[model samples]
Target: MSTFAKAGFKSANYNSFRPHYPPSFYKILTEYIGKEAGKTGDKVGKTIDLGCGTGVATYPLLQFSQNVVGLDLSPPMIETANSLKAAKLKELGIQDESRIEFGVCAVEDFDAPPNSYDLITAAECIHWFKDYPKFFEAAAKHLKPNGVLAYWFYVDPVVVNFEGPHNEKLLAIETMRRAQQIYLLYVYEDPKGLGVHWDRPGRDILRNLLREVDAQIPQDLFKDVKTQKYVPSVDGLLQLTPQDLRLVREKITLKDFTNYISTYSLFHNYSESTGAGAEFLEKMIQEFETELGWDREKTLLDLNWTSGYTFMRKSGE
Candidate 1:
């Protein structure tokens, strides 16, 4: 997360390339919160989104809550998010631009009155948070009884299928295998790759789909806990989660896919260290094209990330 705070980091590129959560997932979340709200005869009121980089996931919360606050440690990210406030409100046809706000603050340091918020969410950012017990304790303290706590993430996407000259599903499986190999070679396995540049425990926690964080959720502090994962497969078989919870599934050009790779914090660190960032990414794109027999510009890849989410409510006293 410190990498995102550097002066040289490109918040705009991070905004442009990163995958936003699907409305469908929000539907699932809001429905859960809605059911809880019914118990108290209260409408969804306020939300605070932690580590809300560039306001991607933060903006969408406006649809469910009357007020939303997005917080991040990176000044640049908060600046970028604040700059887009009016525009996002306009896009949402929201009359009160003040309904949304962005601030520069670490998630752990963010303080609010007890029982102040109806919902608290962390999107693709909670893994970077230290001290899960303290964090969850803070969340439970700040949330109204029965208020919701949710966090979700999307990990490396795999080429599940493609539209190309070779249309066979078997070819798709092979392409996925080769793509995984390329990812490992460039992102992890190679000495010259970005492996050494990654921030630890955070990266490891994310790559494992937040299983560690989920385990430490402190069942006593929260109730009605639910967690789900959508795993991508190289073998030819149907793999699906609930349709509404399918957070990241898209068809994008290989070039666009590589652009997404450029937004990685580890890639930025590697580029700074080696000064061959662009060249290295191009090589990765080329290797994918050459090994998979797909053109970077023309092939449309059906990409599915290994994504998961956990939703729970603050336990009653």
Candidate 2:
């Protein structure tokens, strides 16, 4: 998270290139909240989004709640979120700007009155939080009885399928394997790659889909906890069921793909440390084009991410 707070970090690029959560996921969230609300006769109301960078997961909350507060530790990220407030609200057909607010604060330090929020969410960020037991306790303090607390994240995208020049799935499996290998080499295997640059434990926890965090949840404070993870097949692309939550999917070119990589915190650290960020990306793209025998501009890759979500309700007395 400190990487994002750096003066050199570009929150705009992050907002632009990051993949957004699909609308279907929100429907799942609504149902989860509604199911719990049915017991307590509480309506979905104020929501607080922790680690809400640029309001990506924050704005959509307005669909269910009247007031949403997006909090992040990064000032620049908060600034960008606030800057886009008017435009995003307009796009969402929202009239009032004050319906949602963005603030700068760590999730641990954020304070609210007891029973202040109907829903509390952390999008792509709970891994960065310290002390999961403490966090759940604090979240319980803020949530009304039967209120929902949810968090979800998508890790590195895997190339599952490809459309060749003749619109064929030719070499799709091989290409997918190679693309993923390249991703791993740069992000994990290569000694000089971005692997070592990542902030430890947090990144590892997130890569594992927050299982570590989920395990730390206190049953005394929260119940009806549900954790779902979409695991892509190692043999090839996974066949997504109708019941699956579509967390991340995109048909993108090599350039588009690399741009998304640039948004990674490890990329920033690698660039700063090695002073070869541009060269690193260019070489990686060149390797993809050369080995996969695909044109950077012409090739279209269907990418899917290994993603998961956790939902829980505050335990009632």
Candidate 3:
């Protein structure tokens, strides 16, 4: 398993930059569980969110489950998730302080009683697991009858088009695409003789999470499998000109953008190994800015992204 143990990686920055799963995504999850429960009236009793980074997916889960546990292998991530749990509970006016809990441990090492969880979710980090088949087998053992095992992951963002002068719009779109490519090259290619290969086997499993799961899960262990894509409406502020639709844009300074990139585990590893990872990141940023003609003091990128989910219930009436 790839170590996400880099000391310089910041969970806060990860929380800030990672695109969140849409509300509809969670709604679909709850509705599916409700439908599966049917007349038995079994609401979700408990949930465990694997790799719940900073509680991004865990907090929203509280609406459907009575108790939630956020687990991760990284202590920093678990610490941030616990902190967020406290802040979010207060913000939502939820007084049941025990509703959410967090722990630092690998999925393989974590244990629960048989038939303990009503739901289990892994958000974006399942690929990192060294033994997913074993993980699924363990999950099957822990899930209650008609319980769910759901997971979702988003692909690299795509720059469809930008709103600007007709001519400049095309150029802007291409520039954005090029900039993303450059960033990815630095992360995945390690072109600078850094002896770092940032890409991992886990990354290869992302595009086919369900496929991988299907291959690993015992046929009789799960059923009613479903998959769906979620494309949220882009933010209006990102449009250079008034239009019916545009891509989502979080107004981030160049520094913030670079910090976001630094949150990538591979980047952290590369930096630690070479001691020049920060320098390389600066070089990437400079090239990206030059490509976009960006003024560091007053430029923001409209990041475009979409996500998908796969859900299935434990086999039982």
Candidate 3 off by > 4 Å: 35-43, 161-170, 193-195, 207-210, 229-254
* Model 2 C-alpha lDDT per residue in residues 20-73, reported as the tens digit of each score: 887778878888877332233343778999999899999888887878999999
Tens digits of per-residue lDDT for model 3, 80-124: 887786679886566898988998888889898899999999988
lDDT tens per residue, model 1, 201-309: 8999999989999999888889999888878775525477564346444668888888888898998898888999999988988887767776788888777778889
lDDT of 1 at 68: 92
lDDT (Cα, 0-100) at 139 in candidate 1: 98
- Over all chains combined, what TM-score does candidate 1 have? 0.93
Q: How close is candidate 3 to the true structure, as a TM-score?
A: 0.83
Query: Can you list the residue pairs that collide in candidate 3?
Result: none
Question: How many residue pairs of model 1 clash at the backbone?
Answer: 0
lDDT for position 230 in model 3: 40
Candidate 2 steric clashes: 0
Off by over 4 Å in 2: 35-43, 165-170, 234-237
Q: What is the TM-score of each candidate against the true structure?
A: 0.93, 0.94, 0.83
Per-residue lDDT for 245 in model 1?
45
